[model samples]
Target: MEQLKQALTSAPVLILPDPERNYVIEADASDQAVGAVLMQDQGNGLQPIAYLSKKLHGAELNYPIHDKEALAIIIAFKTWRCYLEGRKTTVYTDHCSLKYLKTQPSLSRWQVRWIDFLETHFHYDIVYKPGHKNKADALSRPAHVAAIQIEGMNPLLKGLFTHGYTIDPEIPLAEKRHLLQWDNDIAYRKGSMKIWVPNYPPLRQLLLEEYHDVLYAGHFGSNKTLTGIAKHYFWPHLAKDVQKFVTSCDTCQRMKSSKQKKAGLLQPLPVPEQPWQVVSLDFITGLPPTTSGHDAILVVIDKFSKMGHFIPTHTTAHTEETAQLFVR
Candidate 1:
């Protein structure tokens, strides 16, 4: 009974591939390597059946992320042909562009070749899963992993940035256009190292999300999130956008620690040793005018003895008058 309980507590483990069950492959690619895990759901949730990893070399190392991701899927299908040939297979990738590989209008000679192999051999659907959600991310990195670079820009972000640069009225302003520098497809200010971001809501939102919402970015508050993002990327009202996104974040709202100071716990005051040893004094004003024109009462109390004195005084009494009354 104890052994059965322990086994149930842990997650499902590797299992033999079931020919009847459809296969799920979660694949990811780093700059120099690609990795994929072959899984099958046999009654229990998705369990690993096999894992594949390959190191990129020469020109392969330089292949853009799209090709590398496609290669990862192709290799997985080739390795698991026996189990996945006739069975309907699903490929999950962090690169969103791979989902539309078949319909992409322009393709390089090598990309077409890679696509040809997969199309002829495999019957599968490619789905987009965020990089943080993909399971094979760890297996895809080289021996020395990067510190904090996100996998790659999402397809939506890339498209938005491209279109934004063209239509952004601010970017073409005389002061900025004269200072802008071009590196490949990216635009930068002549003297600044930060990547210039155009005025695009979707692109800005995605950037804000990637820097603040992702696990590595640590759902930080507006100020810190803005600071981290500003280090490498620049746009108008960047801080304002970060503040808005952070304020609206569902996780931040629910999980953020309260900033209010907690009230101090009540503790009993120390007892006085003798009468008049400690005393408190105050004046209560705003009373109705009295017969003698006195409208306030001076209150004095002794700590040790449960005794108080109420002295009549005018609301406008001077400091000297109050002191004389205290002496009296």
Candidate 2:
């Protein structure tokens, strides 16, 4: 065993990926972190190609074991997408349930997303590897965990959360488990990370506009807009506010087609007492002109009796001539 360690350590630690060879990944997740090791067999059995580790933040730290395990694989793939995009990769996981991840009958919202990305970009297989045998186990169990309150947020928007939390009394201080204070901002705990929106109307309105009224958001209807915003923000009557905002969106009203059709006029014509009392007149032109210069047909129909008459006339016949024909 000591000779094996000496030989392995004396050799190169990390290797460059070879395009001709396939890759193997060993992934593991602890309570607060996830890690993965990418390897390939040049001539010796599975040598290390790269290593990836991510510290969990926000609601990620509270995910179940299987979800954490799944997230580890997703982060590994994302981190080394260029290395794995068009390769045949085999993944080893300590979580046995992950072997059936692709075939699982049901999945969470995030799971579906993770699976979608994996299935779309890479050709891969999941295999069950025991925790003790997995090298990633060490990397997954980091000794110290740092506190990252918030990350990768727009500066102007982050300021809004701070301002609203100060003045808006609807949300309590970070006393409750569901609510948290991360440096300059307060957040709500819903499964993943959701920021607690205050009662301030301007802040709430800005959120609604970003999720619904923005050009990239595509002016989605109330339900979709509500779902999108609710995923990352919280406020009282959020659904109702989204409904009202979408309904009043002038651009949506102008661009979107109404589902209801235009109403037709319902007034009925007066029933004729006599055959010729109420007659309808129409002209069907565009015929070949005859030797007598006649090239059109005048169609007359009586409303009450449903009687009809067809009289031939010139395409440009005088009104007096047609009137004289009708009188005769």
Top model by lDDT, which number? 1
**Candidate 1 lDDT by residue in tens digits, 59-92:** 8866765687888887888888888887789999
Tens-place lDDT per residue, model 2, 1-328, is: 7986565445586677898888899998876688999999999778988878889999996686679889999999998888888899999986767888888899999999999999899999998875557889878853321111135556776787778878876656443544554544566544333467877888888777877776667788897677556534567688888999999999989999997888898998788887789888788899999898889988888898988899999778788977876776
Clashing pairs in 1: none
Least lDDT summed over 10 consecutive residues: which range in candidate 1? Answer: 142-151
lDDT of 1: 0.78
lDDT of each: 0.78, 0.77
User: What root-mean-square deviation over C-alphas does model 2 reach?
Assistant: 18.7
Q: What is the C-alpha RMSD of each candidate to the true structure, in Å?
A: 16.7, 18.7
Off by over 4 Å in 2: 1-11, 142-328
